[model samples]
Target chain A: MNAIIRSTARCLRAGAAAVYLPVRAGARVWSASPPRRLLCAAADLQKDLGAMVKKDKVVVFMKGTPAQPMCGFSNAVVQILRMHGVDQYAAYNVLDDGELREGVKVFSNWPTIPQVYFSGEFVGGCDILLQMHQNGDLVEELKKLGIHSALLNAEKESK
Target chain B: MAETADHIRDKLIEELAAVHVDVEDTSPNRCAASFKVLVVSSQFEGKPLLQRHRMVNTCLAEELKEIHALEQKTLTPEQWEKQKSQ
Candidate 1:
């Protein structure tokens, strides 16, 4: 099953324009050439996205809703995002979308959900995100974007 | 008297009159409960994957609050026969 999940995992290939989509199970990782078009306007989620992206600087879409994560992988991503003090991002439950979950891989050209988009740019999955946090790079990247890297609390100001 | 995978399985067998069904418990994961399923039924013929899975999900909807992940490998009886060739 673990093999089933990873072979299905979509991620940006190192120095590759097309994403590697796993097909015929783990035995094959098909190279799917992604269309080179930035058609955010064509995005199915475009209708409410004006409200969606503006509502949250960071957004996560995954298999289960945040309150109850259906998989261990999903929960791991949520934990890492929280650890970065980024509790404000919106989360869309991908179990709601057959297209978005699969399409998101094509949309972002990266497979896997519990996916993170910062200011609408694909920021990678749990493994990549956690790696960034450990390397002290995620904080700087978010700061550069003027996005809060972690959940900022009010009480800390008085201290 | 209480709920078990076997209890759910029996209910599904009765409800769908299915030809085959397999259920496995995977509750060790931190969320609620999880079950791995492979079901074959004549009723599921011509259905999409999601719909087939949803049928199983809906059949056990009330029971699903206890089940978080349902890894399904649903098939029509015909599809199962085709898979048997592999």
Candidate 2:
């Protein structure tokens, strides 16, 4: 049942990407003519990103989608989330959009890709995530969002 | 110009007053594009992980532009001691 929902979401995301890419490219081409037009685009991107982060409880702006990560750092994030049994998060592939790749860095005020957000708050990148996971903070964080980590049960059973 | 591990180490120590710094060029061919660093500083005492990272990011803003990857582990002096004891 959960898998079905996840696959459906994936399909929807893929469909959205198919439609969004060309439109974004067109906007870029149009904006190139005027200097002020570029500024407007940046403003619009910030507004869009403000909504994008909060759209899901867990949002990741990574180099690639969860299924197929283009970078090792991004792959590590996906694996950590998977270990916690978190499969229903939003993942954006920054590599697909040049604007997004640059926009997100400015939006988050962090000069790095593979950024993570929990409940619309910037949660640092791969290293911080790995630290949280190792130190048991990730499980607590997940619990706060009403998501019980699979590690909690595994630890109980092992004991 | 490409960033070097030694240059990064010096910058961290000077800018952040980092007491202990370990930087490794993790790129396969030693191209200096990728680095892994562990920084221990008194300045990180009260700050959270995100703030600590931001500090490093700001200090190395120029270097980061040319560098491809950076993996950082930041710690306060006390936390560094605790980890060392463990």
Q: How accurate is candidate 1 locally (lDDT)?
A: 0.60
DockQ of each: 0.02, 0.78
* Model 2 lDDT tens row, B1-86: 98989999999999999999999999889999899999999999999888999999999999999988899999999999999999
lDDT digits (tens) for residues A1-159 of candidate 2: 997886566455544542222111011232221111123335766777777777667888888777788999999999999999888777778998776788899999988889999998999999999999999999999998899999998989999
On the 0 to 100 scale, the lDDT of residue A112 in model 1 is: 46
Query: After superposing candidate 1, which stretches have Cα over 4 Å from the reference?
Result: A1-55, A148-159, B1-86
What's model 1's lDDT at B67?
52
Worst 10 residues of 2 chain B by lDDT: B61-70
> Top model by TM-score, which number?
2
Q: Candidate 2 overall Cα lDDT vs. reference? A: 0.83
**Top lDDT model:** 2
Residue-wise lDDT of candidate 1 within A1-92, one digit each (tens)? 99555433422221233222211111333343323322222353343333443444576777676667776767877777667655555666
Cα lDDT of model 1 by residue, B28-66, tens digit: 742336666678888898875545655776687667555
lDDT of 2 at A55: 62
